[model samples]
Target: MRDPNPSETASPFGPVISAYSRADAIADGVLVPVPESIAKEAGFRFPVALTSAAWADCVKWTDADSEAQPTPQDETGRLWDVLYVTAHAMKKAPGDREFEVRLYRVPRDGSTGHAKPARLKSVIGPGDDLSPVITIMCPDES
Candidate 1:
């Protein structure tokens, strides 16, 4: 859906976020920059809360034909301190779209490089003085 403010837009699937610039941070806030092509295909001026990606040996998720559950494991096989960005995106095409907000690991190099996926545990609502929070269960957590 189109937002009243042209500078920002809402995600049809998840939280509305502006385009990610060098200044944006994942842990700092929820807003993040996603693949422009993906955003364009999803008809979102802003970045979606979640998207599929593969980095180095890390694979958040892929465009699988079937909807199978993900294993309770990370790409690293161990835990790593990473930034978490919650966004949403259209899984498929417009006519047959599946909107979802999956947590993604923001790369440490400040570059949208080969980042992994953060296991989605829960979606927490914003507090009286807080915004929407996406709770991710990282491997590092006991």
Candidate 2:
């Protein structure tokens, strides 16, 4: 897709993020030089929130086609803290696309990913926050 601002055109898809010099973005599509106000928030991490774009986007080979590589389970078969960014690339080609974010863990480093099928509940305009806030709701319902 064409960048809205040509003066600062070009974006990342991982692998070559370190050379990113734009004040507006980081490698893997994150907004760079993270806004100071956001950094001052109650809780934050070294890496800012993932941008609508993921580290990489493609027609993914998920489930059994890609799931058995390795996982993040412990000896007792419990999951741990290594969460990979699993996102859904919504929207058709031409206009820029958007991603729905979630954190998933693997027992090891190379497990094929599993993405449950989802239906569009509503049309989210653009950017993050498309995810709904359900303080308490049944997993099946959400």
Candidate 3:
């Protein structure tokens, strides 16, 4: 994953190139990397779970809001940089869960739960400005 905090602290989230126990270990597991198109289309984030109460720790596959406040905006009129986080629940049948994309604003602190970090702003999809779920992210942002 690129530095999770790329704004200033260096992206904590990026390509994770590592070695596993064995080739079968990789084969036996179902770890699917986010496709390049999905990353580009969404801006800069990958699939994640924000439900974790503690963002610093990857407790579960859930996204969460770490800081109690929203991330401060920069020079641009924008409040945050675009970064989509697709969330999916594993299926019993297994292959992979049908993922759902949610925009997230990854603040400079390497936390996806920040109030402002370009994340999903629409419940429908990206570039979708017409909807009740303008802040498709955590209810707090809305």
Best by lDDT: 1
lDDT of each: 0.34, 0.28, 0.31
Error of 3 at 99 (Å): 20
Model 1 weakest 10-residue run by lDDT? 77-86
TM-score of each: 0.21, 0.18, 0.18
Q: Which stretches in model 3 have alpha-carbon errors above 4 Å?
A: 1-26, 45-142
lDDT of 2 by residue, 7-86 (tens): 56544543464533322344544432323344334222222332222211211224542455543223111111111122
Q: What is the alpha-carbon RMSD of candidate 3 to the true structure? A: 19.4
Total colliding residue pairs, candidate 3: 31
